[model samples]
Target: MSEKKGSLSINSENIFPIIKKWLYSDHDIFFRELVSNGCDAITKLKKLEMMGEAEIADDEEFKIQILANPKEKTLTFIDNGLGMTADEVDEYINQIAFSGAEAFLEQYKDKTSEDQIIGHFGLGFYSAFMVADRVTIETLSYKKDAKAVLWDCEDGMDFTMSDSDKADRGTKITLYLNDDSVEFANIFKAKEILDKYCSFMPVEIFVSDPSAEPEYQTIMEEELTDKDTVIEHIVEPAKTEEKEKEDGTKETVEVEPEKKKVKILKRPVSISDTTPLWTKHPNECTEEEYREFYHKVFLDYKEPLFWIHLNMDYPFNLKGILYFPKINTEYESIEGTIKLYNNQVFIADNIKEVIPEFLMLLKGVIDCPDLPLNVSRSALQNDGFVKKISDYITKKVADKLSGMCKTDKEEYEKYWDDISPFIKFGCLKDTKFCEKMSDYVLFKNLDDKYLTFKECLEENKDKHENTIFYTNDPVQQSQYVNMFKAEGIDAVVLKDAIDQPFISQLEQKNENVKFVRIDADLNDSFTEEISEDELKDATEKLTETFKKALNRDQLDVKVQKIKDEKVSSMITVSEESRRMQDMMKMYGMSGMDPAMFGGSGETLVLNANNALVKYILANPEGENTDIMCKQLYDLAVISHTPLNPESMTAFIERSNKILEILSEK
Candidate 1:
């Protein structure tokens, strides 16, 4: 092919301005991009060696060294990796493919972030232009007997390349900081950025020492004398005599003075760890090591309840540590807890996509080199791999939980309080994940014992004939729970905001399994069979009397004869109606819309077997009957089912009046 030489063309003169203004939100990332490029070069060289295309020397070390000089306002990153030849620089640098990175990524579409080569677009190196006034690259390819080359580019899109006499095996990039970006030249400042962004890079990185202490040597002072005039120092006669006496009589005495030495600390900071914990095999890691890693990453004082070490290589290269924190209440306080790292470097502030919203309750780090990073590494584009990774994490978490439940029931129950919200959230948000998680999702019965969904259902199937799950507002539903207990049935307490919707979805997924609110009704039909004929006859007469006693036009009342009579009269809202109210509350609505339930109001069910209801119905004319109905309705209202406050207050006043009348008589 004939030699072709041309300069890069820019679509707009605003390109440099865009790079400086909006391309990078933080100027410190420029160092990260350059250092990453250096690491990539070394990684490529290693690959070449494996391919038998090149033989690397034994003494050859692939590392990046950072030098910062505030006086000269210069920062340099030197790398002994695969350097670019003159032609390569001309094509990659002098000619900017406005869409090179995007086009290259599209061309190698099937390749994941781990497979695709870094700096394909060639703009990452130019990121230095974002913070520097002028950037220069001195490089020599790894090919046998390669000539050195120099490439220079200012903040603008223009650049120049030429042959240089400098002998270098790799590349050296020098950044001349601009007036506004002078902080980049400060060794301390540059080290901080490196530590934050490149703490686990594959290659070693070094920065200059700006905080080195000075060494001092003591020198005896000599007396000054004029030329040809020799001055002899004269000591005091008494001191001389004492010195002579001490020297003659003394055994040798040695005085040890503190040594003064200068030490070059080199900023005393590490920019990278070649091997991260997550990248290692689980067999090689211990529980204490995992816990220590968690503490280092999260800075949390409490140890993790449990963790899932995810290491997969098949579909996509993924690895991470997910910790189930000891979440004691504060369910809504989950945010910015799960961090996302690409190649061991933090990429995003919050990994919302990588971590399911439900898994936000978990706190840990997920490092996957397969996750694509843009020029700035500020955000990630969603792809099939991204979705797959999310699904994989969900399944892994479910597996860990299932194993915990099966292996250690007591410990699992101990963590139930912390993990329940996360499970409920997952069951509500992700349908597929919910299906898998349901197998291991736990429910704590009134007796404080934990059971998986399947186990709980199996245990209750024989007694109740149906898989029944119910949640109660423990304080207000205490009476309702007690009533269920009276019937020899067990109930789960779900008080979290997400529990209601979660159980609703779960009910839809499972077969013969139903979720009911404890206060929905006192009827045993939820757990046992009741004769419809007997129930209908008893409910008919009671409904008529309850309607008459309670102003029918004002109060909504329904009488049901249930097997459980411990609750004489309990107020219960239908499961459907209560769900609407919960949804309304979640959406910040002002109470549930009555129209949504077709104007169907909550009903107050009275147990026909209760003596209180029997006496109130028998002696309708007596003074006690009216007082009893009012007291019974109020009691139901206090059970957490909604009631009109006005009616409740009126009942209290009437009860006081009846008491006064009885006392007076």
Candidate 2:
């Protein structure tokens, strides 16, 4: 190799400093950049071979080898790819922001099919300065007349070029670590970086460490234990060892000796599956293969319920696999791992704005070659294309859900409870998604069956018209659920916290449909109206007694003839007011208890048909009447919510005293 000195064609000397200081948020990204360059180099060579410009052996394997030396504090990426000659190195290495891949693609567009040539800005090589004091590249071009070249650059645009006899037709990049970034030179750290960024790369990557022990592979072979010992029997199952039968009749073969097996160990480490499941045809992939790939990627032991394999080339080139993980609880830690990739190079997992907020609750991998990336390939650039990608992801998820609900409803119903929270969250956040999912939205009724919004209305039309009664807490509202079930009214279960806002969205979507909580208002409370004389004679006295007994002016008590004579009374709270109280509780609004919303306690309904109300009405003012009214009010409060410690103790003592009197009789 001949040697020379030169400067990279950057306008200013501050470019390298800018790249090191502000381009990348994390220093470890420098390793990813360099490895990506190595992959690009290999991809370029393959393209050249495809164009018939160079000869490739039939069995030539394409791979990248990572070599690290802790003593030297150097990390090297060696690839058997297309290399560069002296002039080529001088032009590309001594240039800034000049893309060689772009030029090569332009030159060969008419001759060869396209490949995923990653380096578009050509500044990926300079990222080494972020962690290294110096960088060197040794390359030999695929050109027959090209000479091997050596290029060296310090922490600036100034670099040195030389000629050498590197026989390999590829490039080797070695970075000499700086004092501040020596951690990268560690063997384990280097391997970890490779695994994160290059594990699913299109090229096989092998890490070489001289200090590492040999890795082994175990192989088992069956063999005969002893031929002459008159053992039970052994046969070569691989190549059927048969014995002749003395009898004339056709007979099956018999084994000659007992069988034994030997184990053999072999060692070779290539730490990548270059061809991942996402890169293959959806029809070619089996369910097992998809699950195994998902297990390998996320390390989540729980099997995914279903997956959406997105392979689209039309509007943009996007390939990904989105898995609907088994989310057991609504409040379970929902940290979705969506690994984003640019040309199969790891970008970042937390690209929130690019991925819809709802889809952020899923685990998956997305590789978009055409995604506009910053210099570090970590931050995504804002553009219409990015917005399109986000919308497309939302569309794909909606489509998958729609397909599931239509094709396999029995199986889909099983996942509705687990997946409904995510869908409801999406609807609350995205209007388009809400519109798309309206038909596919499945609501479970009291009969343990699922139905659509229209179906719910149609099925319950005779009992409740245009009104959808739902329960937030199945346990707390089970009493009301039973009451409604007796009247042939099926209430949908809206158990998730997100359902707080989702009901409003559903109502707005269908103005004719009105959603009501089962505990919101009793049906009989509005069914009957009292005459003027009845209010003066019995209802007014009843209301006054309830007000006096509860000892709270905020309690608004109403008299109604409830349907169930077995019930003493029931409590009903306004749905709008309750939702407001729930929202205030979430924010921890100062000095606000959910029990006392809008400076008022729960609305107490006095059942006119109950026997206890008639006795309380007969003696509305006496101390015994007061005690009975207090107990009745307390019982209603207990059913609706928990009573205070003091109130509960008093109630228990009074109940025991009454029980002791009943035992005396």
For all candidates, what are the clash counts?
0, 6
**Candidate 1: which pairs clash?**
none
Per-candidate RMSD vs. true structure?
A: 9.3, 7.9
> Number of the top candidate by TM-score?
2
- Indicate the worst ten consecutive residues by lDDT in candidate 2: 224-233
Q: Candidate 1 residues 1-665, lDDT tens each?
A: 12333445544443454455555667777877888889888989899988987779886767889988888888898988888888777766775555564454344434333333334355777778787878888999988877788877765655677787668678999988889888878877987788778878888887774343423322222422221222222332221112235447734333443333322212223467788788899999999999888887788888888888889998888888888877557444644377788877667655666777777777877888888665656555656767888888888888788788789878887888878888888778887777676667778788877777776777667666565657656666787777667666788877676677777676776666777777776554433444787667656666666666676754555556556556677777777676777666677874656556554557877766678877766666566676677778777777765457887678778879878988999
Candidate 1 residue 648 C-alpha distance from true site, Å: 10
The regions of model 2 sitting more than 4 angstroms off are 99-120, 211-266, 350-354, 525-532, 535-539, 593-601, 621-627, 644-661
Candidate 1's displacement at residue 36, Å, is 0.4
TM-score of 1: 0.73
Q: What does candidate 2 score on TM?
A: 0.84
Q: What are the TM-scores, per candidate, against the unseen true structure?
A: 0.73, 0.84
